[model samples]
Target: MADRLQGKVAVVTGAGNGIGEGCARLFAAEGAHVIGIDRAGADECCDLLDEGATGALFQRIGDRHGRIDILVNAAAFAVFDWTETLSYADWKATLSGELDIVFLATRAAWPWLKASGSASIINFASANARHALEGSPALAHCAGKGGVMAMTRQLAMEGAPHNIRANSIAPGFIKTQATARHLAADPAFAAQVLRKNMLQRLGEPDDIGWCAVWLASDEARYVTGADIPVDAGATAW
Candidate 1:
């Protein structure tokens, strides 16, 4: 059987590891020509936050692939601290980096997405944006993701006439390299996080990848401007 994304060209940010890596790999497996970008040193890593980098990637994609069918914004960073204690630099790194990367990538890929007639842009958000996490200095992340949610909706509205769709995924407590770092620091905290989930287990990278696949494929052609939570029902309770 033919693959679902056989002729699609996808750009996935933060594709060096974790959920981003999962999305890139799965998209590739589904027959899409994947361009994985990240800051980390890996096969597909590109520092998307750096000025001009994201645009350059999109330019390269256009020049080489001729079109982009999917753009997944999954690059993010966080500095944990109370609102009063968080530094300006940390906040900027968390919020500005995400916004800059997403904006630049979207703008760069706008024409191709419009041309594709069924293109999709997937932005990554966090469940922390919906519920407060005790003792976690996530104000910047929450604010940034909230902005992503808004941007997703706005883009959906603007792109609808052109057949481009934008949607966001808010993941909770996924077992990614980043989350593993936190889990290593406090096993008890990890346990607490798992317990809060309706499934009573941590999520895998593939969980989010599958959702991205659905959103990017024709299966979800009607879905746009929605924030879908792949949080094991963590938001339910």
Candidate 2:
């Protein structure tokens, strides 16, 4: 049996860990040539927040790959604090990181995606973008993700004429490397999160990866401008 994404080239940001890593690995496994990008040292457990660095990564991919069949923008930043105590710089940093990276990656990959004949752009949003999770102090982070959804819809409409589809995935509390440290320190918190889910468990990277694969594949050829949630029914509650 041939792979679903054979002969395709995919660019996945935040590919160093968590959901992005899962998407990259799964895309590769499904026969897509994956260009994995993250902030420097992310491949070796370092933070990736440099705009120039991310731009350079995508530029290299465009130069080498010539075409990007799927572009997954999964890079984001958030600081959990109450709105009152959140500093201006912290708020700006979180929103800027997500907005800038998503914009840069999409712009850099535009030509290649256009050339691919049929391209898919997958932007990452959060469940909080719709239903706010209590205690999340970073209101700007929530707002930025909402921006991502709007952007996704607009881009999907704009890209449609070119046979390009833009969509977003709103993930709810998945177990990612970044969140693991916090969850580990507070098992009770983690347990509470799990109990909120209809599945009675938190999500894993593969859960998001599978949704990404479908969205990027021909199977979802007609799907665009939609925010698909892989929240394990967290949104249902």
Candidate 3:
């Protein structure tokens, strides 16, 4: 439990806040030297959507660290809209934010990960990737996360040859700053979420962060190409 990831070098995107921050803090506590990346509110601020900047940033990190034992792609942005009213531009932007960012970061970190000979890549999917939340207008989010799910399997397959493990975590309605706005707009949303959740409560960032910790550690050496749901059983039904 303690020091599960001792001496590992971890790069966590979107570590400025929310689940990414939770994971970064936990990884460090477990003795990993964590590099938190975000446009703001992280150890290394960079707009991951910028291809050149992202690549350069990863190169710097890889050079400084020698190897990257774990890569957590948790940064994302989405403009939620009903499918009927969704625009092409918004869709593309969502894919770019959610799906493309993952690819860019992974692509940039590939060399360093391979150098480690036993690296782990943890991606963030969502319950939306599997099922729709009744009140949530997240068409683009669903598509993006679905892409992440498929891409994770592909990454696992490709990474297998290099002893690198790839997997994803599909989280439910965790209470984060991002979700706070929705909660404010619809006073009944929280109650509805609880009704659907078997655990009968909103999840915290730590709920998903713990799962990321295990996946990043050697304890999950055999768990590649899997999508673990940290949804408080909301999707179980």
> Which candidate has the top score in TM-score?
3
The clash numbers for all candidates, in the given order, read: 1, 3, 0
Estimate candidate 3's RMSD in Å. 0.7
lDDT of 1: 0.84
TM-score of each: 0.94, 0.92, 0.99
Candidate 2 regions exceeding 4 Å error are 41-56
Which candidate, 1 or 3, would have the higher TM-score against the true structure? 3
Looking at model 3, report the run of 10 residues with the lowest lDDT sum: 192-201
- In order, what lDDT does every prediction score? 0.84, 0.83, 0.95
Q: What ranking emerges by TM-score with the best candidate at the front?
A: 3, 1, 2
So what's the TM-score on candidate 1? 0.94
Q: 1-237, model 3: which lDDT tens digit per residue?
A: 579999999999999999999999999999999999999989999989999999999999999999999999999999999989999999999999999999999999999999999999999999999999998899999999999999999999999999999999999999999999999999999998888889978999999999999999999999999999999898899
Q: Whose lDDT is higher: candidate 1's or candidate 3's?
A: 3
- Candidate 2 structure, TM-score to reference: 0.92
- Model 3 segments beyond 4 Å from truth? none
